[model samples]
Target: MSDLPPSVRRLADGLRRLPGIGARNAQRMAIAVLRAREGWPEELADAIRAARGNVRPCGRCGFFAEGDALCEICRDPKRDGAVLCVVETANDVLPIERAGVFRGRYHCLGGKLSPIHNVGPDDLAIGALLGRVRDEGPAEVVMALGTDVEGETTSLYIAQQLRSLSVRVTRPAMGLPMGGSLDVADALTLGRALQHRQDVGA
Candidate 1:
């Protein structure tokens, strides 16, 4: 049984459920929140609630947005629709955006194909991706997926699907940490990696 107050213990338990947050870190964060001067907890709760309520998947790319329609990036006219970058998740968009090397639009796959977890191509947004590619008629599709087995598998599948299309498919040049999440990579590293992407074969 936890000796902390019910509210504090509840918050700690909830925090612990988050990825990378252990019991000790959760307890520390809970204590820190308890020590805050003003309505920090309220602010945090409001932010969480706002995100949960307002954020929805973008219609074109599967990125998170405040409305039921497309996200800001996908809606922007200045973005290069002729080139699309395929990534694993909505969060993965941040690092690529930060790199500023890609002026193109994005296609979030929701996740990589994981046969072990029973997550197959059907489970991902592959159909939507194919539809978007066919409709948009992009010149190129840049795959910014991780270098893990699942990532490679997903990339190959996407490349295979695009083979009949006129669009060129490519993968980022080596340099990114294998099996690493793009969300955590430095901007410069990612930019360099993007600048040297290699063509994917048919």
Candidate 2:
């Protein structure tokens, strides 16, 4: 790293910060960007900056949006407002949307309830989720989170919290594994999971 120019090394470090990027990959990417023709790197940089500055979380659903407006999904007039799908992070939203099985709005919890990790109801978007339930009055909320221990705990907690509300809580069934993340699941699998959903307590 010391042998490389300071700017190149810095670019590599920046690339490494992205998810799934490792040392070799970041260095390769940095080298490619440095060797690219005029205007390409500047375009990438400008796009990155533009996204960082303009993209904001949707106030109602926690998905990414431009400015203070709701995300495209939440703003869609044809989406099934009566059905809401809840997931752990904004990344999880993309896969479900790709599956194209659900035409409802979404709520991103940001994370799961992990007692060992010191994450609790307050740490997640539970309050916002409850508020959405009350305000939007969705007839059902599908917990599209992972199937791990933390996910289970969060699911049950959410079900309990919404128990008093006149809403049916369910989870994707069949296709997902015991410790699967929705982001990594295939589109067909996710579609099947949504199609064969099961009630939370059942």
Candidate 3:
């Protein structure tokens, strides 16, 4: 805002850069941060700094990890290693985990194929996924990507690549919106979708 001081304006600008945060929300956040209890800002800054400095992608799954270690899901021996759930981003994993239906491990692709956006297979974790499938020989792979055009393209490409393998390929059922992302789906919807997944003919 033109009337706001430079410091507050800068804080609002930074907050506005976050997903789904608009101008009004950014201003409110800036005001809240400025008016918070003593030392709260320092604590928030420290937390952000620590997470940024320490968090890294899992070596196998591309999910969030700490330094060189694997993610919690990848390290869990109780999880089903024979089934891998593939998704567009690390954020997509949380909703499925919250749904509590899939006991399998995950593989984040970082992003889907988007020619307009210049995102291709090489830009994602497809190679690593193929290598894992070849080495580990998973029984199944669930393509839990979005139903958008880019997502469809990526899924088809992956399925084509995996066609030579013996594993079965499937996708979440029709309950999920035709063009929606996994992150926006509610737990109940995600659970139901996973429970009724359909074959991809891979």
Candidate 4:
């Protein structure tokens, strides 16, 4: 790394900072960018900067908000206000949308509970979720969280919190395998899970 020029090395380091990108892959990407047609890498860099600068979290659901208003999902009148689906992260929202099963609003919790990782209920968007539940008056809150232990812990905690409220808290049904990630599951499986969700701690 010390042998490479500062500019090339800097690009590689930046690439390596991205999720799932390793040292070798970053180096290759840097070299490829250097060898690509004129303005190829520059265009990509500009787009990344633009998106980072403009995209913000939705004030309502915590999803991507393009402007000052609520996100598309939150603004949609056709979506069911009686139900709300909660997920661990923004990434999980896309998979559920692709499944095309849910017609309710969504809330991204930002992350799941993991005491070992020092992430607690306070670390997530639980407070905001509770506030939404109170304000929106949803009939049911679907826990579209992951199947991992941490996800389970998070779900249970959320269910307990909402127990006193009038809303019913439930989880996606059996189609999702235990310990599996929601993002990796096929659309069909996810749709089925959403279609037949069961009450949690009922």
Top model number, lDDT: 3
lDDT of 2 by residue, 71-170 (tens): 9988899999999999999999999989889998899999999878999899999999999899989999999888778988999999999999989999
- In model 1, which regions exceed 4 Å deviation? 175-202
Clashes of each: 0, 0, 0, 0
Angstrom error of the Cα, residue 78, model 3: value is: 1.2
Q: Write candidate 3's Cα lDDT for 11-68 as tens digits.
A: 9999999999999999999999998889988898999999999999999999999988
Best by TM-score: 2
Better model by TM-score: candidate 1 vs candidate 4: 1
Q: Indicate the worst ten consecutive residues by lDDT in candidate 3.
A: 1-10
CA lDDT, candidate 1, residue 139 = 94
* Candidate achieving higher TM-score, 1 or 2: 2
Candidate 3: residue 195 Cα off by (Å): 17
Candidate 3 lDDT score relative to the true structure: 0.93
Alpha carbon lDDT of residue 16, candidate 2?
A: 100
Between candidates 2 and 4, the TM-score winner:
2
